[model samples]
Target: MEEADSCRRAALEAVADVEPPRLHEYLDSILDRASMVPAVLTLESAAAMRTEGRVLEDADEPHRDGESEPDRNRTQAVSSDRDPARITTHAAGVQLIYEGLRLTRSLAHDEPWTATDAEASDADLGILAADILVARGFYLLARTDAADKAVRTVQSFGRDQTRREDLESGAETSAGTAVGIDGGDPASTDANLERDVLELAVRTGAVAVGETPSPRLHAVVAEFAADVGTSFPPVADCLTDLHARARELSLEDSTTDRATSATDP
Candidate 1:
């Protein structure tokens, strides 16, 4: 939870330097209106699965035994507290804000809406906030220790969000899963979007931690995402399952384990 708050503050700090206070206020209102607590909790949990308390170095640079990355670039400490991966989770959450603004005609912060004449202007501002957040989210990812993987994960995020937001059921997801965004006729019960976001978090953090995830680890994260996306009972149990499976595979190299209990009862 502390980690979440830290990342939340980091997110605010991301846009705090805007020259115009109005734009900054819009950004602030977006986060201020959204209950980012759950999203932050999931992000911190996934980030915790990564290497902890270790300073990251450029993968391009070689290191001796037991040596951290070369300290030539002493710019910032990406420790768990300021994890960009976790912060990206919140950045991606701007979509939720956009959804609220468009669907509810207000930010839902209980702000005065008497100025119905200002609806278009407010919507424009909200859209701008969402757009800035998307760019910021991708920017944060591109700055990670694993730039390639981080960027790809965010790309997948875009595709997944587009697939879900298309309002058309049975859209073929990039992963080849035909998930129904709406409940009218869900071809696949797997359209749980929470799992997709969390899985991306796990994969991004895994790469950031100097590890290539195994298929079992992927399956574990996917299952947890599925459980949480579908509102399965005891979602925390899903997270526990992910932690145990990830820990088990952590002890083995990428080649040893490929099968998992995903299909098990």
Candidate 2:
């Protein structure tokens, strides 16, 4: 859980320096939901464990004699200071990206700006905060193997949002009344966001541990996401099960490869 806490702190620190006190406050408010278990971080941690054949709790082991402060606080490293492959860094990247998308979803669905001039300004700040959070996420991932996947995740979000917008417009234009965002199915859009981001988390985590996630691995991750469906602070037992399943799947793939190679000769 230290890794998850570190990820949450890193994400907040990433956006801490935004100008305008109100904007910083707004950003903090937006990230308030991060108090949950951080599903993306959990997935990434699980995948990393699967790839390394190690345990997540190992990070929590007591330090050896004379361990420096930096060693104790490595989990809290800033975006530029940490290794790109560190699971905490990668997890924070996906976390920021998801939070940004989540804020955007709220703006689109709630339309909070239409309330008044002050609310309009607040909405603008919210948009700015979302941009900052996503940019920070990309900054964290810019040098990692998962960079391309991270880019695609954001692109996918844009495409989904655009599709939802077009659908909303069609509904309003035809029905002569607001049919609600995505025809009163906001949960589906949010689920799509969570599913894609969680997949990215798994891929990035596996990459961090020096393995490219196979299709079978991706399939298992997808199944896990589908079964969980946007539940935050994922259950510990479920995460442990996912970790075991991923390792099993990886082992099966390795066995299949060995068998195929044996017959080829």
Candidate 3:
């Protein structure tokens, strides 16, 4: 969908200014492998459905009397000004933050380094890209309602990773696929990263529409994300599933609101 395309473009554009062509290319490649589906679509659909019937103009720029038509049109197509594409920036922020965390996890797991100068350079640039992505993501959500959730997600990631390293360092046997979120196993820690990030997506999306996700909604997202079993999908299927469930829950919530409103004096 439109939300995926829009959010991906926004993410790529956000990193367009990274110095050195090779580093920029590396960052682009990382993003290319990312499924810009879950977080962005959740945010877009929530905001769109919640604010139905209202026009949300692209707010990236104030219209100028003398601005060129093409410029205005281009801005509107990618900017988070309206529904379907509403909250593109916020969605992009959640996506980038997740990607950055994912990258950091990879670096921690692999420690990719070599004797060759070029390989070492690439490794260094990878770290740089991760930092830039997280920083940029933070900048986007710095003023949004999801800011604290985003921060907590990152903090949780750090804690999980740290615990995983400590556990691995002392463990006598490989935990394998049997590991779980409570077992202090490496795989489960990794799953927790995805779980927390996905939860952030759901919460961020809901709050973007002025609604807090109910506890049941959080439980649903967490369970789905944790059960992905290690590697995350590089397509929209997983996120699509989440969006469908979230939408259903949101509809239930909306119905309750309407019923309560109708009964109020």
lDDT (Cα, tens digit) per residue for candidate 3, span 42-120: 5644552463333445556479888898978755653443334447777888889988988888887877775478766
Residues 1-265 of candidate 2: C-alpha lDDT, one tens digit per residue: 5555566677777788887888888888766656323334444444533533332334456767897989666533332232333567667777788888878887877898779988888788888888988898889778777789889988888877776665556753565655443354545655777788877787667656545677877787777667765455534546667666767876787677778878995
Q: TM-score of model 3 relative to the true fold?
A: 0.78
- Against the reference, the lDDT scores of all candidates come to 0.48, 0.67, 0.72
Candidate number achieving the greatest TM-score relative to the actual structure: 3
Give candidate 2 regions above 4 Å deviation.
Answer: 35-85, 171-187, 228-238, 254-264
Lowest-sum lDDT 10-residue window in model 3: 47-56
Better of 1 and 2 by TM-score: 2
Kindly report which residue stretches of model 1 are placed more than 4 angstroms away from their true locations once superposed: 33-117, 145-193, 230-265
lDDT (Cα) of model 2: 0.67
Q: What C-alpha lDDT, on a 0 to 100 scale, does residue 37 get in candidate 3?
A: 55
Give a tens-digit lDDT track for model 1, residues 111-162.
Answer: 4344565875776576566667655655555555544543454455455445
Query: Global CA lDDT of candidate 1, please?
Result: 0.48
TM-score of each candidate structure, all chains considered together: 0.53, 0.71, 0.78
Stretches of model 3 off by over 4 angstroms after superposition: 44-86, 114-117, 171-181, 262-265
